[model samples]
Target: MSALLDEIFDVAGSVVLVTGAGSGIGRTIAETLAACGATVIGADRDEDRLGEIKDTQGVEPVHLDVADAGAVDNVVNSIVENHGRLDVVFANAGIARGGGLTTPQGTIDAFDLTAWHELLDVNVHGVVHTVRAAARPMKRQASGSIVVTASTAGLRADPLVSYSYVVAKAGVVNLVRQAALDLARWQVRVNAIAPGPFKTNIGGGGPIDPAVEARWGSTVALGRMGETRELRGLALLLASNASSFMTGCVYPVDGGALLQSLSLDPAE
Candidate 1:
């Protein structure tokens, strides 16, 4: 058993950058990090949301769009230039585009291509650009932790979801491994979070899709969607010295989703 002090996630002297910190799980992560004593700089495309985070939570807010390559670099430069040191970065920005190959008629080519590009632009390239921009300063500082949000679709494609979403999320998983190895020399750690069905705005916000609600009601062992706050402990673990030796690993937070083998592996 570890002592309370030893197990505590320490960030008292560190600064953390959380992209997409305007709402949902991202907002939860930023607020939790701040509550744990880290000076959090929350970045999001929604200036109004950023304002809310600032006014309500007192977190330092910066407007940023991770999908914009230029903004990725500029936001990172400004943060490092201002703070003089960045200790943690959560590349949690993402979007979901849903459509099956069997969509009921109408511009099939446009629909498929747009879905692919939009998901990739926001999911894969978002992480890539964010990592690239943050890495230089983190390397110079000689310490940092990066957490990217992947998905259960990343581990295995779900016919229930669009192909583009799975492909992009899977890319994030591998990107974390590659980045971890690349940054090890600089004392920076890179890892990812593969979240299962959680109550968030990923799949068209509002109430859960009736179909998904019915399925999770039975299909999931937990028997319902997860609350965003449940991820706070894991988020802080990945962002702090508590996980000093962990890297290049895709930590799945699914409620037993990955453990079930549904005759889906490529091998017979």
Candidate 2:
């Protein structure tokens, strides 16, 4: 049984790259893969965060901004050039800069266009850039796995998240399917992880308010937000041979949040 498990979950020696790896789900994914014996490359725009993980064994930290198409291309190319292979990529870098309609700044009538465009640039264009650049070598090798970080907001209307967050994620969800189809011909797999709320730095690094947490918890069937560690198992599965036959699927690791509505009203 142990051997069977190893065969399925083993990712030893594989070269994997994770963007947005400075913190949150991306960091967990990078750390988990490194611990499992894969050569992990963690990329993030924050130099300080990169510095934190640079010394971690099996992890090669790279300073990068995914929104910059040129930088993303260079990073992807450099990886293949230096290592000769990139078996997996987690295009996970993203930002949530705006708020829902409940707040004055988040209201549609007064929506911040600058914030919207900035978020889209990173969340949408960044994913596109990463996937496009990674596909080059993956196609040449005739094998690779690209995992995207989408959100539950993208799957449905939610008043809790910002407009940019929802719009960007929704774009990537379909982009995953489209890319999966195109890459399938080269034996490359593309998939999306549509996560619900987890304890992460996306909302700025700190503990969430008790009241907000309570409200968010109520929307999830599990009655709470997920921890970053809960994502490791699924991420490993998607990254390893266990999911060799899987592609183009958006797996939700949301503690069953997708099953409930994002309504704050008790009457609803």
Candidate 3:
């Protein structure tokens, strides 16, 4: 077993591109891969954030909005041109905005046009454009891994977060499955991570409400919110040869939160 992991999970020399690599899970993934010996290219719309990350971990940084069709393709092209090939593409860029019909201030309400567009643009269209760009090269290479970041809300509806957040994440999950099937013949693996409430900035900006977070933790079988590092092993597993036979599957790393019926404010 130990020998198998040593051989199968070796990421050395692989070229990986991680979108939204400026912060949170994307950042974690990039740094982890670098430490594990993969050549990582990190992309983000925030130039300064990208620069900061670049300075720290020696990642090649490219600035572009994932929603922009031309920019998306350009980023992919840049990676191929510079690295010769991209072995892993993690489309983990996403945003969250919460609102119900009654809350005119909510992100999905008609009044929140900018927020709604931002959510759809970054969360849905971004993933679409990104994966579309990656598919071709991965197909030609006949081997690659694509991991998408979805949410627990994607599996079921709840009032804990914004409506659009749930919808966008759900769409991402389906996209992973569909892409997985389409790329199977090419030996390109596509999978999604249905991460539960982690100490990240997606739904909650930075600091989660203590009470709300406590409530969510209570509902989880693990009795705590997940650490970002806990996901590193899982990410490497799916991206490496360990999961050569796994694709078109959504792995929920939610500490079993999806198993509980109790509703906690997911936004926290």
Question: How many collisions per candidate?
Answer: 0, 0, 1
TM of each candidate vs. truth: 0.89, 0.97, 0.91
Kindly report which residue stretches of model 2 are placed more than 4 angstroms away from their true locations once superposed: 264-268
lDDT (10s digit) by residue, model 2, range 1-268: 9999989999998999999999999999999999999999999999988998988888999999999999999999999999999999999999998888666777678889999999999999999999999999999999999999998988998888888888999999999999999999999999999999888888877788888787778888999988999999989998998999999999888889988766635334
**Per-residue lDDT over 1-268 for candidate 3, one digit per residue giving the tens place of the 0 to 100 score:** 9877678899988899899898888889988888878889889888877877977554778897999989999989988998899899999998777564335554443546667778989999999998999998999999999999888879987556667787898999999999999999999999999888788777645688898679668768899998889899998998789899999999989998988875443443
lDDT of 1 at 189: 95
Task: Note the Cα lDDT for every prediction shown.
Answer: 0.81, 0.92, 0.85
Model 3 alpha-carbon drift over 4 Å, by segment: 1-4, 100-111, 264-268
For 57-119, candidate 1 gives per-residue lDDT tens digits of: 536899888889999898888877888888899999887786643343212454567667888
Q: Which prediction has the highest lDDT against the true structure?
A: 2
Rate residue 215 of model 1 by lDDT: 59
For candidate 2, give the lDDT of residue 190: 97
Which one is best on TM-score?
2
Model 2 pairs whose backbones collide: none
